[model samples]
Target: MLRVASVLSFFAGLVAVTIWIATALVEHAVERDASRRSLEWAEFAVWHVPRIDDLAQGLPSDPAELAAFEDLAHFGGVFRFKIFSPDGVLRFVSDDPGSVGSSLGTHNEHAVAVLTSGEAMTFVKDGREKPDRPDLYSETYLPVYDGDRLVAIAETYMDQTTKVAAVRTEYAIVGAALAGMILLALLIPSGSLWVMFRRLRRTNAELEEAQVRAQASDKSKSEFISTVSHELRTPLTSIKGALAMLESGKFAELDGSAKRLLEMALKNAEVLHLLVDDLLDFGKLATGGLEIRPCATDIAGLVQDEVDRIDSYDADRQVECRYTGERGPLFAHADPARIAQVVRNLLSNALKFSPVGGKVFVSVRERCGAIRVEVKDFGCGIPPCDQERIFEKFTQIDSSNTRQHSGAGLGLAISKEIVEAHDGRIGVTSAPGRGSAFYIDLPFCEGAAEAGAVELRNVA
Candidate 1:
């Protein structure tokens, strides 16, 4: 019973706050609209009121002019009017004529500011507190300017009772309708909540079923990868080795026709070998089974070896790969073998994309506490749009030139994963028709600092 009482008290407090906020919002909106109308009325008075500069000078001496002021107070739905001299002394009041020669004390500064700035200030009142006049009124302190000088300020109070009442009643009716709908919903709480909970449970069950099926599908994919790596790759590697031996002319020297066929076989077999390796690497990365063994290793030397090895591969293009570096080694704490794999991938990618007989440039340098390696190729470059998703697995950019080159697109994705595992970063910069430069930045470790640039070039 105590807990139930506490909950009820909390809910009652929330309801009170919500009602107060709603009421305040409605009041503010009504007041804002009233203020705008009041300003318009003040502007009308500024343009139409006729006094011939007599009011600004002092109380009107002309009886006809005084009568015009008196008639204006009762006309145009205006409740009352009070005119003040430039010094804020009350010059005239339509309702109370006797109280006219006094200074406007507290409101004097505000009236002077409004008149001097040539702007009017307006506000709305509910008028509930005043016992004598309990009706809505809009008061505007309208400034009257004569060329450069503030001539006078007029306090115009207009009746806004009907409009204010209509707006408030409309807001109250809508609020009441919304509250009644909420009460009706609360009355059937058990039925509504029971149906809602049933639907929620049904959704939960479907999600659980989907989760189970996804796990099974993932298991099947792993099994397929295992079979390809073990059963297929082993025989494929041996067959490729045999084909390489036959193409080398050391084992069973053949004629041109046979040699050409053997060369083609060996080339396709190498492609198959690369495809299998990429698939295995991707699978390992996906399952988080691929590990990085970090050690203080020479990053420059590592890159140089990969650069030299590029010439050995019989790719589509026989491009010359150049390695540029300083005299000393740029060392970083990284998995040498994994980094080598990344370098190998980038080099192959560069070679594949390069025009026949074009040059591939490989560079290693220390940059801001990181050892950076870059592989650049002067090929029909990748577009800006495709550069974003180039490192994603199975992402082959759509281009006529790119279509000629084939792979599972897992090389760069695997390279990215490898670099990140070593607390490093990898990316590419390319623009169409210029070239592409793929780079990897590994955190610098304690090693021999490097300076001076030397280039090493090897043509395949």
Candidate 2:
């Protein structure tokens, strides 16, 4: 949860920073454009003022020029112009419709600056004194000259405070937006991570409690099994001794029925002994008490020995064992005795499932940086779904009440444990009514590089 929060916060902060920079850059660009346009318009008004003055001076100073000036003044709102003769006499007044003749002097700084310097001037003017007029305006004054002499002055006022104010407002809005974005980026991911951490902490607490309960339950189960096994061993020993004595005729000669009963009793005793041994072995394996001593053992030879043992087990069926591949000693890093035990278990399982005169093939090969051993049998194969579960303790593929084979069902489970202790993997492949192949793959401890080089190009 902390990890997730850190990543999200980093991304959010990055996005916020990017947005802030982009907004600042865009606002700067807008302000630059606005300033450029405003300066261009000011320059245009200043340069064009001379043309207006020339038209007024050349034309006749009669009702025609006066009427024409009046018409231009009314059409151009908020614009006022004053035209004077060379003797400083007012020739035209655009603001007054009736006044045709008037005298003007340098009474205002705006008009004085333009007339004296014969240059354009710009200034801001307040419109409060003129209530019927708009407020907050900028004025551009242009001087009209005939040759080297000043003729008149033209002034134009444009409303522009609103545009300046809009730019200011946009800047303020962007600042506020940047602040809001930063807050959201920090707050949202942090709050979510807080909630996630709370839930995970709760889940971890529950898991700890469950572990405690499982440990206590397991302790109780182990104690109970140990106590029961001790009590059963005493009776089993007595029963075995009495059955052996009767078989030897220590008390009296037994009839056919009596002898048969003794043999049955001995068989059952042996079965009980096997069950106890399997239980003990399972306990040791579970508690990590089982030990293995590994060496470079001839895996093929070990497999053959186990196969020979299987052959000794008398049955009407002939279970043939065959070895394939390079017969030269195929060595593997494993306990010879344990390896043989695992082989014996697989062979026994195969024999039980095979029909009369069925064949069991054992093959050993060094390949893929490991020693591969496979035991295949032409027997009633396990179901596909049951193949994985068959390695589990007490799990039998054939669960019918009248199943032909019987055992404690711990052989394959123990075999798997032993194989894995040597850093190996065991698996089975089977299909119904076809056959089953049980295999073990163990890492080679020595000469692996040589073995691998030789086997690299050997495809199987």
lDDT of each: 0.77, 0.69
Per-residue lDDT tens digits for candidate 1, residues 1-460, read: 9999998999999889877977676567655664565555545655666662467556435766666667766655676877777666567777765454445322466567776676666667778788655477877776665555566777777777876667778877887898889888886996889899999999999999999999889767866885677677999989998998888888687999998899889888888888888788877876788988988778888888888777877655568998876544677888889999999999998988888999998888878878889999999999999897989988888535647888878898999999999989999999999999999999987643332122222221
Sequence-dependent TM-score of model 1: 0.56
* Candidate 1, run of 10 with poorest lDDT: 451-460
Off by over 4 Å in 2: 1-48, 51-168, 174-208, 215-252, 311-330, 356-374, 399-404, 443-460
Candidate number achieving the greatest TM-score relative to the actual structure: 2
**Candidate 1 clash pair list:** none
Cα deviation of 253, candidate 1, in Å: 2.1
**Model 2 over residues 154-181: C-alpha lDDT tens digits?**
5545554564457557766887797699
TM-score of each prediction: 0.56, 0.58
Give the poorly placed runs of model 1, Cα more than 4 Å off: 1-9, 12-212, 248-250, 399-402, 447-460
